[model samples]
Structures are given as C-alpha cells and as structure tokens.
Target chain A: MKEISFKNDILPLGDKLYRLALRITCNKQEAEDVVQDTLIKLWEGREKLKEVDNLTVYAMTVCRNQALDHNAKHENKNISLEDSGVDGFDNQHMPDERLIYNQRYEIINELINRMPEKQRTVIQLRDIEGRNYQEISLMMNISLADVKVTLFRARQQLKEQLKKQKNGL
Target chain B: MDYKYIEQLLERYWQCETTLEEEQILHSFFKQHDVPEHLQQYADLFSYESEAAQECLSDDFKQRMLDMVDEEPAVEAKTIKFVSRITPLFKAAAVVAIALTIGNVAERTMQDNSVGDNAGAPSIADTYTRTEDITATIHIIDRNQSESMAKADTVQVDDITRR
Candidate 1:
C-alpha cells in the first residue's frame, strides 16, 4: 500500500485502539506503548494490507493482542490508574460537577477493571468502541455466542457495581 | 427532562439488550442535569462512560508516533536481504575457525608427545608443575596484598571475602 494512503486510512483508528488499550492496560503510558507497538506491527505487515477486509477491526485486534501481552508481562506489578489523570471530562465543569464526574468515572472504570479481561474487552469493543457483536467476535477471535455471553456478564456486573455504589457499598 | 424512556433503556442496558446507539442515547440523556431525583445516581455512570470514551492520546503522542514511523529505516527489507546473504559466510567462517583450532591442538599434542619421547624423560606433569606453582604463588601474593590494603583502608579487619 502507498504510505500516504496507509497513514490516511489506517492511522485514524489510533483513537479507537488507544481506548481499547487504555481499558485493557488501565494506564495511559502503557496504552500508548501498546498502540505504538500495534502501529509498528501493522506497518511491518503492510505488504499484506490488501488481504484485510476491515482495517479498523484488524488494527484493533493487533492493539488488543499487544496490550494483552504487555499486561501479561507486567502482571505482577501494581497498575496505577492515577496516570490517567483528572483530565478529559474535567474541563468546562464547575468544581462540584468535576468532582462528581471524576468520582463516577473512577467508579465505573474501576468496576470495569475488576471484571475478567475477556469480559472487559468485550464490553469495550461492543459498548465503548461501538462494534457489533459479529465484528467484535471476529476481532476477538471468539464465537458470536461467546461474545454475547461475555458482554452479558460484563453489563450485569457493571450494573451490580453501579447499584452497590449507589447504595454506598 | 423526563427519564421514563431512559429508565427503560437502562433496564435493557443491564440486560445487554441495548444496541450501541441505544446505549449512546442513555449516555447522552444522563449527561444533562435534569435527571429526576431517583435516577441521579445512574447519571454519573453513563456520563462517565461518555467522558471515558473521550480519553485518548495527546496530539504530541500522535506526532511522536508519526515521527517514529518516519524514522524507521525504509531499507528494512534490503537489510534483511543483506543479512540473509551474509549468514552463510558467517557460518563458513565459524566452521573454518573451529577446524583450524582443532587441527592446531591435535598437531601440537602430536609434536609434544614426539618431543617427549625424544627427550626421554620430561613428563607433562613436570612441564606444567613449575608454571602452576608460579601462578599459585603470584595469586597468593596478590591476594595477601589486596587483603592487607583493604584492612589498612578500613580500621576493622573483617574477613569479608569468605570464599
């Protein structure tokens, strides 16, 4: 593929890849590293780019695998969510609103992090990344039913966590 | 704003029956400030989802990534080709070195035995024993000097090197 075309077509998926990596690794620097590695791997395999039907899905798979590998390697180390910082949703809000938003974001992010990796990833792909079940299943290399089952569990767990948080649990 | 529709969607959301768009609608609905008293708690969670989705790498990161791609050697394929071509040469060189070393050792051993026979008396042990003793003495002297120097540097003579 032409370098210009590749960059134009493929690089825009970086944001989606970043979100997946962030959700998986739960740290900004590690997520960025994963995305960087994913992009480099994609570039290395650019010769086979034509065979890919959906570049976004392909790129996401690469990013997910790289993030998983990074998580595996650093499994024994404590992952700090502090590196995500109090930005993104912090701007344009009053102090009280910002605090509330941050608390809620933290709670939900933490709840998602608590879920098993497969469940969390499926939730991310289906809910946050807005991918369909078939697409997510394909990207995740799992069956459609497996994707649905995982997403079901993830949403159920998230709901339970949210309810518990509401009850001050 | 009325949240009856949102409340229903929220139920479906928990059941994993909502589509991505419907889920997005819930997030948008909850992002506003007009949720009823009973549903306020769920607002933060949905709004948080919207906000978390927006968390992404900075522009500086994007630029750095692009620069990295740019910095990658465009001749990577050529370099791989070159390495493949020279690999056989390296293997041949390694083999030749090993063969030469073995041949030299064998020739030296044969010459040594012949010389020993001609000389009629000097054993291999005799030839090695003097050098071994000299090395041992030198090592002992070096060790003693180092030990003394270490002790002089420190007021306490601790036997730290306990081998």
Candidate 2:
C-alpha cells in the first residue's frame, strides 16, 4: 500500500482500537498508550499490509495485546478514577442530563471492570464493537465456541449483577 | 409500561439464548426512563452497557496518535542510519581482536618451540629446565658475592700486618 493510503486506511481504526484498549485496560491514559503502541506497530509492519485481510482486526489484536501487557505489568496497582485522564465526552450537556448519564456510565464501567478480562473483552467486541463471533475468535486467537461461551457468560453475569444492584444488593 | 417482550428477552438473556440484536433490543428497551416497576431492576444493567459503549478516547487522543505515527518514519530512519554507521566499526574491532589473539598465541608457541629445540627436550621438559636454570643462576650469584666479601676481609688483615 502507498504510504498515504496505508495511513488513510488504518487511521480510521483508531476509535475501535481505543474502545478495545479502554475495555481491556480500563484506563484512558493506558488505552491511549496502547493505541499509540498499536499504531506504531502497524506502521512498522506496513510492508506486510497486503498480507492482512482485515486491517481492523489486526490492529485490534495489537491493541488488545498491548493493553493486556500493560495490565499485567500494573496488576497489583490500584486503578484510580482520575487515571482515566482523557475526557472524551462533551461537557456541554445539561447538568441533570450529564449527571444521569455519568451515573449510568460509572455503574456500567464498574460492572465491566469487575468482569474477568476475557469476558469483558469478548463482550466489548461482540456487543459494543459489533464484531461477529468468528472475527472475535480469530482476533483473540480463541475458538468460536470459546468466544460465544465467554460472551454468553459475560451477559449472564451482567444480568445477575444488575438484578442484585437493582434489589439494593 | 408494556414489558412482556423485555421480560421474555430477559429470561432468554440469562439462558444465553438471545442474539446480539435481541440483546441490543433489550438494552434499548430498558434504557428509557419510566421502566415499569417490575422491570426496573434490569434497566440499570442494560442501560449501563448502552452508555458504557460511548466511553471512548477523545479526538485529541486520536490526533496525538496520528502525530506520533507521523514521527515514526523519521525515528526509524535515524535508527537505521545509526545502526548502519556503528556496525562496520563493530565488525572491524571484532576482526582486529581475533587477529591479535591469534598472533599472540602464535608468537608464544614459536618461542616455546625454539626453547624446546635448544634444550633438545619436550616442550614441558624444556619449560621446567628453563625455570630450574634461572633459579640455579640466581643461587650461584649469591655464593660468588659472599666469597668476594670474605676475600676482601683477608686482604684488609694482610695490609694491617705489613703496616
């Protein structure tokens, strides 16, 4: 691929990469670092671009690996809320609306954070990112059945947790 | 207030039977306000998933990432250049070190062979003979110096008798 085309083609994957990184790392700064590292890796491997059938999936794999590596290194450290650091959402919404959304967002974030890494990652890919099972399985280097089972378990767990939270547990 | 469909989906959700689209439907249905009291408990969970999807890195982050990529080519090029420059020197040093080691070994071996030939002995025997000869030479020098001091004392005694 021409340098310009490579950049144009792969650049659009940033958000998807960011979301995947965020799900895995759960920290905005770490997510950004993962995305940066992923991009650098992709750029380094630009010569092999033609061999890649799905650039997005390849980039996602790289991002996921980077995030997981970061998580491993910082496994024992506490994840401070202030560590998200990057505020991607608009600040212009009405206070009440922001409050409600923020509350919902925090609740969901907490639930996702509580999930096992694999389940959280599978859910993020299957639900939020809308990737098919086969694609997720391929990207994550797992069997399709594994992907489905993980997603299923993740959703089931989320439901149970939500139910308990609703019941004031 | 009609939640019979959501209630059914919720049952399927727990059983892991709901498709992604169906799960999304459940999320959307529960995301709205005024969920019936019976279904309210599940609302927060689905709504949270829906909202969490929007948690993403900012545009500024994307721009910064692109900028970093933009800088990569230059950095890579410089690194390649740096390595290329240093590699020849490393190769030359390696070659010189190998040559010097070989030369030093060859010289030591030649010296050992010459000494062996002069002594008409095996290399190890020659080496021992050389060490023994050095020690004997030092002992003979020490004996000659002591005899010379004794002779000087006798000559002083004769000169005093003549006076």
Highest DockQ scorer: 1
**DockQ of candidate 1, scored on C-alphas against the true complex (2 decimals):** 0.37
Best TM-score among the predictions, by candidate number: 1
Kindly list the per-residue Cα lDDT of model 1 for residues A74-158, writing each as its tens digit. 8765355455433345445559866765666777777787678899899788777678988998889999999988888888887
**Number of clashes recorded per candidate:** 0, 0
lDDT string, candidate 2, B1-163, tens digits = 5667888988887776777789888878877787888777667667766666676666787677667677666866897799999999999999999999999999999998888789776555555467778789888999999999999999999999999
TM-score of chain B of 2: 0.43
Quote model 1's TM-score. Answer: 0.66
Q: In DockQ, how does model 2 score against the reference complex?
A: 0.27
Worst 10 residues of 1 chain B by lDDT: B154-163
Expressed between 0 and 1, the share of native interface contacts present in candidate 1 is 0.60
- Per-model DockQ against the true two-chain complex: 0.37, 0.27
**In terms of docking quality, how is candidate 2 classified?**
acceptable
- Please write out the lDDT profile of model 2 over residues A1-169, one tens digit for every residue: 4442435777778778888888787777777788888877787787787688888888888888888898898876536544442356565664987776666666777777778889989888876777778799988999988987898888888877877787785
In model 1, the Cα lDDT at residue A162 comes to 69
Off by over 4 Å in 2: A1-6, A78-97, B71-163
